[model samples]
Target: ESNRIESINQSIQKKQGVAGCHYFSESVISPNFNVRITLNPDRERKCSRAVLRLAQQFPGDAGAMAPFFLNYLLIAPGESFFMAANEPHAYVAGEIIECMACSDNVVRAGLTPKFKDVNNLVDMLTYSMGGPNIDGGAYSMDNADVIRYSPPCPEFEVMILTVEPGKQSTFKNPGVPVIMIILEGSGAFDGKLCRPGRSYYWPANTDDLIFTVDSSKRGALKVAMAHKNLHLDRPTAINREDFGGASSSNHLNYPTSPRLPYMGLGGGSTPVNEDRRILSVGSKDYAEQGLPSL
Candidate 1:
């Protein structure tokens, strides 16, 4: 934690830690919001969306200048970055695979007809001047194919797994529950065709899984997974049988904080495709992992 973060949290520890990560699938034309954005519109606004504009579309709120101070960046396909709590950002354009904690307590800075708590928002923002680097985004784990993105909050982390066509890759379970989505290409998972936009659930401590990317796709198969932050930064392959097979009853390193609304807050310009897909896990699994029921 940096002094800046500590200072921000000190004002309100568990108040509104809203953070997330994004993996760009298409080369963004403009405004990949934060990667967060805030009050300052220091430079010329390059991108304008149907929702927000420095010219006119901005709501008459106090911070309406942005649709201005809010930061914007262009991201190439396959690049990603983390958005810490309180950082202001918006994806003004392009499609992105975002993995964020499911929280209803989002503080919209602007670009929406919804409530804009500009006063509270002003207090929480880091106001860290300058735009972020597009090149310096998510990092690779022990497996280069897996682009690892673990944000500051403990709510969740994300993984982008890519496999080339006709090439087989094996991925071992990390002894934790994970929800996956196929971003591109095609494959088979237990008789189900895993193709773009398809999702799956993998149980904890499952056996080594193998994938053979379909040759007909002519492109790499990409999958994005949202899983518990199981202290897996540089993860290595693991076999469940070798550990004697008691994969359940796992707990986190620290006492789980109250899964309240986001510590920091952000919302998209348009409300339609807000990626608010929340899948319900079984109560039995929650009990085993010390997780609360959704």
Candidate 2:
């Protein structure tokens, strides 16, 4: 404990300078006074005093230092990372395409002037400390024209579609709602001219959506698509006798059939061709129109 406190004090001294340390020492001397010290963001390196304070407060929580275990990820174009729920992560820099479930609940630990819910974050974390799995592998379908990123979560799956210039590709909708974003080159989506920065949300069972890259375009058409993983096949029942007994409670039961309505948007009994009055407007207008009212 003493060694750990010394190590923290040394880091604080190096980052906070003499005046900050003096202020901290004086605050420590006062029983009624709160130790409110801010480190110089420009000078501070390695650990933060705020993080040390959090660690000191919750010595039993191994997840308190989970942020420190983070490894820098240099994600190039067309690369991606999948972060599960309750996984601790922070983007130090750079911008990339991000697809995530619609949830506003955020528990920040540090690296922000906002409220730091350390206790809540520690309690919610997975507590697994290590660099992330950076393998950029995906299942390829249709002669490598389509790449699917099937994360373990049943919520969503991402698909990358590539169409060479003057060529076309057809993707059979998996009977689920989907959203597509054009990443590069120009293309026609179901006969609509779409270029980079264009996005579309298709209702469930859109069936045989086609993408044709314009021959006039110089590069291959790249698009990132996301949709619910509702069509995944699973076994109906488990033969428990092979493992132990049929009456055992540990026997697994997978879904025998596809779900009636998909889990995400447009999951109702709405017909796919019902002309849901889908609008193809600019992003600025879409934002003004709000969330589809569907």
Candidate 3:
């Protein structure tokens, strides 16, 4: 016990500590509303949604932003470098469906106050180049219904979906799990309906899910999706485990923080979990190591 206390004291002894640390999937990321933004475009602006932050290991203080938010962000499909890091990011006023490595370790700099370790936050962040800059607006698809954007990250990918009234879109998860967010009009999946503000998750091991738009209006459905892809050689399960129902109708009730083993103030330091069977890739037994399948 004396040794442990000494170590803890050493860890926080300096105003600015170590030069660096890496993020692993072992961390936990609890959801917290760091800030809020409202848009009013009618008076030169309309009502826009509130911005929310997601990170791997959020130090949860004001100083954390100095290192993490110091960089800019740009997201696209197939292009997914930002998601791989443990920096705190905001989903500014737009609904996007996101699915990741089944880990939530956020190291924040300008968001919450869960763990205000400024020294680690500054050291762990990547001061290199900013985020991915692929714009789907540059490409014109003649055959594909969905416009896929490739950011640069390998752990995740995104798709911008546009469906007309009475029409539908189909995607096969293969094994990787998927998350969908409604960006425009109303739509329904399986049987549950979603509008401009709702979100849903399809378990990693699930099969292809169907999305249908309301036939009452033209272009009634627009959705953005974030999903895991097959990049690493490791095998993962494709079983569709329900995220289960919300503990409360409020989004605040869900667990947004990543789990343990990856809990810390810094970001992008955890190792990939050998037991991750949440998102299926190619093989039936796609474990990083060989663990009993979930």
Top TM-score model? 1
Which tens-of-lDDT digit does each residue in 95-154 have in candidate 1? 666666675656665456677565556565554332232221344545667765554445
Over 230-292, each residue of candidate 2 has an lDDT whose tens digit, in order, gives 424421111211221111111111111122111111001111111111111111111110010
Name model 1 segments beyond 4 Å from true.
1-54, 59-64, 130-144, 230-294
Model 2 ranges with Cα > 4 A deviation: 1-67, 230-294
| lDDT computed for candidate 1 | 0.44
Model 3: per-residue Cα lDDT at residue 175: 71
lDDT by residue for model 3 over 253-280, one digit each (tens)?
Answer: 2112222111112322222222121221
TM-score of 3: 0.43
Candidate 2 steric clashes: 0
Candidate order (lDDT): 1, 2, 3
**lDDT of candidate model 2 versus the reference:** 0.44
- State every prediction's TM-score relative to the real structure: 0.58, 0.55, 0.43
Ranking by TM-score: 1, 2, 3
Clashing pairs in 2: none
Q: What residue runs in model 3 are displaced by over 4 Å at the alpha carbon?
A: 1-100, 111-114, 130-134, 137-143, 189-193, 201-210, 230-294
